[model samples]
Target chain A: MLPLRVKSMPADRKGIRVDLQLVADMIEPGTRVLDVGCGDGTLLDYLVHFRQVDGRGLELSPDGVHACISAGLPVIQGDADTDLKDYPDDAYDYVVLSQTLQAMYAPKAVLTHLLRIGRRAIISFPNFAYWRVRLYLFLWGRMPRNETLPYTWYETPNIHFCSILDFLELCREMGIVIERSHVLDSWGVPRMMGRSRFLANLFGVQAVFLLRKSG
Target chain B: MGVTERKSTGQAPTSLDGTGPIPGYHVRLGCDSPLRLDCGVELFDFPTAYQTYGRLNADKSNAVLVCHALTGDQFVADAHPVTGKPGWWEMMVGAGKVLDTDRFYVICANILGGCMGTIGPREVNPATGKAWGLSFPVITIADMVRAQAMLIDHLGIDRLFAVVGGSLGGMQVLEWAASYPQRLYTAIPIATALLHTAQNIAFHEVGRQAIMADPDWCGGDYLDQGKRPLRGLAVARMAAHITYLSESALHQKFGRKLQDRKAFTYGFDADFQVESYLRYQGSIFVDRFDANSYLYITRAMDYFDLVESHGGPTKLFRNTPVRFCIVSFTGDWLYPTPENQKIVHALNAVAANVSFAEVVSDKGHDAFLLDEPDFHRVLTGFISGAWERRQGHAAAQG
Candidate 1:
């Protein structure tokens, strides 16, 4: 037998094309993966099948669970708002929060849980510091609703929004370590994602960072 | 552990072995023999009429079990038996497709309550020398999964690559995870909820009432009368079918489309196109399905609530060490995305590994049964991913 991981990788490789390369570069073989707010099990699926990582995902929808089940993918039906406490400390190789930080009620608590439960954590989200959002606030003086934040003010699910600079500041305050970082476009094309950390406050549109708890 | 329980690998592998036999039909493995339902009803030596298009690898690590919804047969990607129509999910399962049978061993079964070639009210009871009728002991979704687990065991497969289903079939998938998490590497539940909410129960009750109200239905003894509960079952189907559609979809498809008459008919003869379409659907369904099975099955679904069964807040799987992926459709008012969201929230409470997707479609609860490209893509990706995880674990041991 070629091994289970190799057999499962090719299908997953087809879906997470761009992200697959990125995950392969970042993750080592045999790592345990926990992905919160995993949409359709895409990233976790990629990491597990392609990068030889063990995957667990948290998603809060039935249809999502259904598709996941039909595909024979493993996942849990859950929300990041309240489900973070279920994990034991230092149980995972990595905890990942991807594109979900801005929608949280308590991003800090979630990040703390990730660091506590895993050796390292990956956090990614749209940057509220994006130039379009800045222009909307600066020129139109509105809450800056665009493609990422399309819903009306009353209906938006995003209760809190933070920029890359704001998130890094929080990390610094908590004495966290940034192992690696990435930024991507809407199409998930990686660019100068972590360049100019100091100026990322005004110019960064997306951010992905690896964090570890301060010892 | 016993000699009889050993897998019969020498048996002539049929279409049920998880491979598609013909075009437009995706095949998966089915038990070469019959299954036993919790109702003490042996499927009376029935064949698990399934089709698979993929090859089961030597270690059986590529197997993915597909559970069908209510009214769904095992012919997931082939022509329908009676209607001669295309398979329900031909788009999602095929060679080189998202659920590509060429890659993974996909297995689908006609659920116990189904009108298909599986044991139901239509099948004769071995002890009684007559159809089981309403005499069949009621079955829960857990019972359905239990039966499925038996089929999986029969194949010499130690663990399923994944378990996937929609609607009632989705219920079985969830139950499989809850009751036997160790057996499945992953679970994908689409368009199903952890519980049957009050509103859903009410809808089911209405359908039931419509079935029993017919004069032909002699309480539970009408099967011997040679007149199946056709009128009642048709009406039941018609009423329940409306809930499967969204208001937006209904409005777009059949809003005030007049029948083949310029003027309104004074009599109640299906005055509108919507009315005629519904009538056609109901009448057609009655021909292919057994009415008593419908009653027993819907009752089972009505009582299904995973949280309630788990005693409260279904995060019992926090330590189960399995993964999940949940899919929902925007227009599926039957199970609704909110119900799926509730499940996700609960899994989140336990910090379990899970994923969520709300595919944008007007197909309602039936979307999972259709040619949804997005659904196929996500599912194919997830299964391979779970397999890889198992492989990595194996590698570490070496």
Candidate 2:
């Protein structure tokens, strides 16, 4: 067989999003990783290429799954809410679920399954309690529409939107330890959310947390 | 098993136990070992007709077995000898197509109860030197898969990279996943059901009764009596053909249009273009297909229920290492999306690596057999990704 052309991961290593790159940086090299809701598998491509990790993905939509396959990524078409229970305990080193927590049917159950399926689970979601969102509700008395949370309430797929504090509380209740965290502004630029968790919860547009079992 | 590696010799190396690498040729296996059938009968020296394309790699991990549908044959990407038409899947199994004969060793075989060169009702019985006819022991999807496993063994390959099929062929693929999960790395079952639905079985029964009612059928002994049940077989084909197509397709192609004329004849002639089309389909089918084979194969398909005797579908893939890609079409009411979804859910419950694609096509159950662009893209993407992953795994192990 001839050499395979590595796609998803470009040679320049500049294609990945900043938030995704932060998550990638936290993952150790040569580990098995599963990316839940991995759309187009861009992060997986980057991980497989640079980090030399065995990467797999679970995407719900057909287009995303096909795109991932087109990029030669081993991604399966499955829902995060219901399908996570099938995975054996600690089957992966790192299971990453980015920007898909809000749309889940049962966020807590999915988060619990994630903690059990991988040694560490990385999750990123838009914080509904951000200052801009809070002000939009306080002043206009309607659901906030922004770059990340663009959908109206009637048409929104985010059935269980949560804030950074809500997520942390659930993690605490589940006895999951937050190993690392990154906060991004509305523009996806990493902000000081890492330094002060309180201010981050109040102002950060997005939050990414690296979590593990709190033994 | 002898390893006949013909490196750069430009000839198929012959194995000591089995015939050489006969690509594009069908091998009639005289099964030295008895094949115990699901019907509790053992077939002694049954034949399995198969065709192959591309070269088997040195490691033999790139072999893909393409199972054919109820009426399909071993000609995956070649011109059918009788019909002179392009192979059934010519669009997806050629040089640059999804299966990509250039990259993988592609093998397709006529099933055990099939008429096209494989052992069927028409074949002469080794015991009595007469056509097996109704004497042929009833076979199931599992039996067909067991026969294919023997062929794979004869080819001296330990594991198949993939097993792929649609409809009844998909049943065989599922059977392979259940019976010999270790022998396959990936399984793609498209536009198929886990078992024959009541409605589907009703359809098959209607078709079967059409063949049986004909006096020419002569109690399944038409061959000895020098008779052909063309009328009955044609009727069966015509009735079953409707199920293969969707109402929307029918409406689009020939929506009450008169055949060969703008005005209706009002006679018993094929006034609607759809009738003429169905008649044409039935007439052509009888020319190439055997009536008795139709009876046996449809009976086998009707008898198919994977979970019941197999200890449920989840158990089938409980610890399976195989990955699956299940596809269903929107307009395919024969198997439907819900049927495919059931299999997908089972695989999910077992934590088996699986994917499901509900392709939007108005072509009905035959969508898998058609050249739908989305279907092609999905298949190509899945196979390519699987190949790359297999390569990565091998390289990592090294």
Residue pair clashes in candidate 2: none
- Report per-candidate TM-score of chain A alone: 0.84, 0.90
Residue lDDT tens for model 2, A1-215: 00111111122347687778878988999998989988878788899899999788888777777777667676777778877776777878999988788878898898889988899999988788889899989999999886666677887778888889998899888999998887877566776456667789887887889999988
Most TM-score-accurate candidate? 2
Q: Candidate 2 residues B1-398, lDDT tens each?
A: 32222221224212111233223445545446778888898877566667788889999999999999988988888887567689998887878788988999999988898876678888788789888889998888888888899889889899999999999999999999988989999999999988999999999999999999999999999878988788999999999999999999989998988888878777999988899999999999987788888888998999988888679754667878998888889899999988887787677666677767778899999999998988888888888878888888889898
Q: Where is model 1 more than 4 Å wrong at Cα?
A: A1-215, B1-53, B310-315, B387-398
In Å, residue B212's CA in model 1 sits off its true spot by: 0.7
Local accuracy by lDDT, each model:
0.71, 0.82
TM-score of each: 0.70, 0.86
Compared with the true structure, what per-residue lDDT tens digits does model 1 show for residues B26-62? 2122335444554565443433334555889987877
Error of 1 at A197 (Å): 13
